[model samples]
Target: MTSLRHNMAYLLTITILIVSVGRLGDTTGRRRLLLIGILLFTLACILCGLAPTLWTLIAARALQGLGAAIMMALTMAFVGETVPRARIGSAMGLLGTMSAIGTALGPSLGGALITGFGWPAIFLVNAPLGVLTFALAYRNLPADSSGEKTDRAGFDIAGTLLLALTLSAYALAMTIGHGRFGPLNVALLLAAAVGTGLFVFVEARTASPLIRLAAFRNPVMSASLAMNALVSTVMMATLVVAPFYLSRALGLDQALVGIVMSIGPVISTLSGVPAGRLVDRLGAPFVIIVGLAAMAAGSIALTVFPGIAGYVAAIAILTPGYQLFQAANNTTVMMDVRPQQRGVISGMLNLSRNLGLITGASVMGAVFALASAASDIAMARPEAVASGMRTTFAVAAALIAAALAIAAQTYRRRRAADPR
Candidate 1:
């Protein structure tokens, strides 16, 4: 329970505040807000390191999430400000590479820090790095346009509150049950539904909205967001299910499972730059389909093949495809966003991805447990685990196929409209 709280605290905070902070950046200044976020994150790291109680650490982690939300929201928006329009894919790819590297390194680094120094060392180690990041960003990030402040509309405080509530309720609904959806989950879901309706109603009436309702009218943007969510859900299934498959189905111990799990992030890290360059050369629309196709193939491999070799092959195929899709999808959405709307749109992108992840962890885990026919997955038989693995990947494949169809449809629409 403590571990779960620790993990969820950060995720919940980030999911709730990400969009609001991004919008705030647009009004105040992305660079200024980003610098403040970095400073806050640095302080949160120190607080975490010195925390004497588990609750305090959790609180500090939430603070870290706020900082992370600001950074994540602005960083992509920065691509538009700093990079040339032609190299947008490359910039997105580099961001993806950095993210992949962090994901790959986090586990090993955290484990080593715990072993060598203590739990606090993991948090404390970031202090210096955070400072260095702050310095670099302050020195290099461009100043906000003078007009950004002059022409900005008032920040939508009411809309921000409603959206945050809606997201928080939904995230809790997905996460609180631990695979079993009971009354609490149902109630939370209902609350989320109501909140969503209220948010739309308010946004439609407000002079300055958190998300301009008309933004969703863009078929490309809407399709891209939907595809992003679906792809993220499928990608997350690998993270949630593969560990159990490795340990129970294949009878690998913890160490072997960790090594096997590392392969995905390693592959993702290696593929990020190449995937970005592919998008640059071939264009985002074409590369999006290619990435989805590769993912579908990878999912099928996981469903049909059993054993370490097959598992590795599936991950090797799936991971790079994810990087490809991420780079292309992000580029597609951000490439043409107006300067004023860039921050909010970037936040929406991250919001979709994060929501997908939360859903996958809950929904995919439920699917795996149900398919395995085991009340307790930890004690499930090898055959049962294998069955669950196959079923989960089958569902994953179906999700990817859906994403592929969306990509194809979006591409067709774009071609029809531009025909050049």
Candidate 2:
């Protein structure tokens, strides 16, 4: 539970704080806020390194999450300001590459650090990196305009609080049961639904809403967001279900399992820049179809083929597809956003991905358990684990197909309207 909380603290904070901080960046200055966030993150790393109790560490992690929220919210937004319109896809791809590199290296690197210098080293290592990042950003990032100050309407305090509470409730609802839905989860979910309704009502009336409700009316943006969430959910199944198949069905040892699992991230890291370049050359709309098709194929492969070779092949196809989708999807949203609205839009993009991940972890895990007919997954038979993996991925394939359908419909509508 302590370990889970440590992880959840960071995610929870990011989910709740990202949009608010992103809006703040738009009102204040993205560069200025980003600098402060880097400093806060660096300081929090040290606090986590020296924490005396588990709760203290969790608290520090949450603080670190706040810093991350600010940085992530603004990073993609910065691309719009700095990068040329034609190369936005490349920039988004570069971001995806960096993120994939971190994901790929984090586990192995952390294990090595812990072996050499204990668990604290994992947190402490980021201090120097954070400082270096801050220095680079401060030296190079563009300064905010004189007109960037907040207007008389100011920040929406009520909306921010309501949204935060609502998100927190939803996150807890998804996470609290350890994949078992109970009364508390149901109640929290209900609270979240009510909170969302209230938030919408308040935003409709407020002169300066946290999120402009009208934004959802844009079919391109709306459909893109939905596709992003669906794709993300399916992508997460790779992480949740593959391990059991590898370990129980194929009988790979822990070390071998780690190595095999690294395949996706490694592919993701390598493919990101190339994928972005493809988006630039072929256009985002075309690349979206290609990416979704690849994902659907990979998901189906997981169901049809067995053993580690099949697993590797599926991941090889799937990861690059993910990279392509991410670059194209981000570019589609950020390319033409109003300069003032970039930060909030970036936050919305990240929020969709995060929510998708959370839902995937809980709901997909449940599906696997149910399909396997296992009371306790860790103790389940090898055949059961394999069965579960197949069923889960079959569901994942369906999800990708749904996303693909959405993309196809979106494009058909676009062509019909424009006829260009």
Candidate 3:
């Protein structure tokens, strides 16, 4: 129940908030929304920390997701609005680096808190940070939502419903496939397929879709969003599975595993700034291709070499690529859209990435379960689990390759359309 709540609640809340913030873009000022989001998120975190019941915890998490969505959507739009186009890439890179640092720190911090105190400590620690963020936002953020005439299009209620159904079905399938559910797993998978079909149908007909179908008409934006999904999936899979491999297969202690996992984010943080500079100079497409290629190489290397040494090496190789790809992708997406529509575009990009993470986690968990059941594979036999990890990486690589192909096609189409 906890697992279900955590996964579904986070996914649903994030998706809803993204769509809501996008719709509210024209109605509310960006800075105002951002500040409000920060406050809501902080409050939600506090609620999560204090909640005594499972349902309460889920509700808190949902609220946190909403707040996070608001902040994220506006942050992207805010950057696009305030920063010069020429320097947007650099700004995005720096933002990516900060994100990498936070991600890198989270596991270690959470673990430490859990070990030192308990599970609740993990949620509780957010309070101080939330306060700090709120203070910063209140003081620094401007009050600017002024722009062109608002898009008076009606809300895409059908699209939103379909999207929620699709995500819920996918999450249910993953949990069931992982053996968390019994006979209901197959039903969940069927539901996912149905929901996805409905989503496609809704998207095709919606006059003002939650996800702007026409924006995808731009090859660059489409390819970037697609590749973002693929790369994000691979990255998430690696993060989820790596610690288990280290602790069970390699005979490493949990503390050591935590340290090893931190390496990737550290590398990512270091690489992000430079990648941003590169994007500014070379263009988003070029940077994205290079980043994707590097990530692919890293993933392939992990598949080939699944031991502790190999894992560390993979982190070294992949982290920078991941950071580069993220920074470049954000720049690409922001540049592709107009300022007024930045909120919606940002929400879409985030939605794609979050969806990818959910998919990867669910699929990879099932892979692990199957592999474990087939063999006497304890976490101690890292090589035994290596096969499963390898499969996951290989699949990720394939996805990245597909993304690369799409990106190439997008570049060609854009060049053909505008010779500027």
Backbone collisions counted per model:
0, 0, 5
Residue-by-residue lDDT tens digits, candidate 1, 257-281: 9999999999999999999999899
| Model 1 stretches astray by more than 4 angstroms | 151-153
Q: How high is the lDDT of residue 160 in model 2?
A: 94
RMSD of 2: 1.0
**lDDT tens digits by residue: candidate 3, 1-420:** 686766578667886558558656644567777888888888888888888899999998898888888988888887887788999899999999889889888877877898999887887788898889888877876666445335545667778777777776666666554535556877877888998788878888887776766776776777777888888778878877787777876778977987888888888888889989999999887787888888888888988875778988977888888877887889988875776677788888888887788667777656665664544445335556666677767777888888878777877876788788
Give the worst 10-residue stretch by lDDT in candidate 1: 145-154
Tens digit per residue, CA lDDT, model 2, 243-303: 8888888899999999999989999999999999998999998899899999999999999
Give Cα distance to truth, residue 388, candidate 2, Å: 0.6
lDDT of each: 0.93, 0.91, 0.77
Per-candidate RMSD vs. true structure? 0.9, 1.0, 2.8
